[model samples]
Target: MALTTYSFKDLSGSMSHPTIGSYIFTGEGVGDISISMSTDRSAHDVASDGSIMVSKIAGNNGVVTITAQQTSPIHFWLLDWYNTLWNLPTSEWATTSMLLRNTSTGGSHVITGVSPQKVGDIPYQQQGQRITWALMAADIQHNSK
Candidate 1:
């Protein structure tokens, strides 16, 4: 019913290198949510073809069971110049739903229907390295007592 933003940053050297990011949600009765991402570039060529992997930052044995809704769409883009407009979509785009556990165990439960869709160009920029992803949850019609 309500919308919240969870942000994580990669402190690793360059965009070419892989780094782990983390996010934490601490609210009561949190259920049914969607997630998405936005990039700054319009295409991903040999010069800048990088991928982002989203997962629970905490180990697989923690206390929360985070799930993605079916309608939620994940997206990526590639930009041309700095603040310019010459971008195109990339060939590597996909979406999937899964359940992430926050514990010491190292495993995840993949859910069905929740997947990422390639709707726009795949951008590649060092400044755009900060991936902006969002999640929307299913509507809570009402609460019964």
Candidate 2:
């Protein structure tokens, strides 16, 4: 058998928001999961051994861009959904999988690691298809365990 993998940074074609194990996202049409990451590093230098230690580890600071699109989409309710997800109780954190798994793809991916913050500044744009404004997430995978 061959092992396949998906990336959060993937924003290729029309794709639905990845399933949170089974926690489904309502209203779907060409949804996409686009997120970004940044890292902060510290260096330690000791004269005793003349060695410097550099670190570039996971579970650092990062940002998220969660969005969805519809051909003849709902105009305004997206704002409500975006704001609602942001303020959802900590328990309602959207646990995301690292692999791409949707109705078009296959079953659900089994890696629950992403936790998004409140979606902010939902501004819609129209290109080939009507798309929901890319709402910025507070944080994504800042504490990967």
- All candidates' lDDT scores? 0.24, 0.41
Cα displacement (Å) at residue 72, model 1: 22
- For model 1 the local lDDT of residue 33 reads 31
Model 2, 133: alpha-carbon shift in Å? Answer: 6.4
Residue lDDT tens for model 1, 33-106: 33222222233344334664444332111111223222222111111111121121322111222333323223
In model 1, the Cα lDDT at residue 135 comes to 24
Estimate the TM-score for candidate 2. Answer: 0.36
Candidate 2 residue-wise lDDT at 89:
65
CA lDDT of 90 in candidate 2? 55
- For this target, which candidate reaches the highest TM-score against the unseen true structure? 2
Task: Give the Å error, residue 122, model 1.
Answer: 3.5
Residue pairs with backbone atoms closer than 3 Å in model 2 (clashes): 86-118, 123-133
Per-residue lDDT tens digits for candidate 2, residues 1-145, read: 9886644333222222332123233344435554565455554556678876666554444443445544323223444444554566655554333333344334433323444344334444655444435433333332221
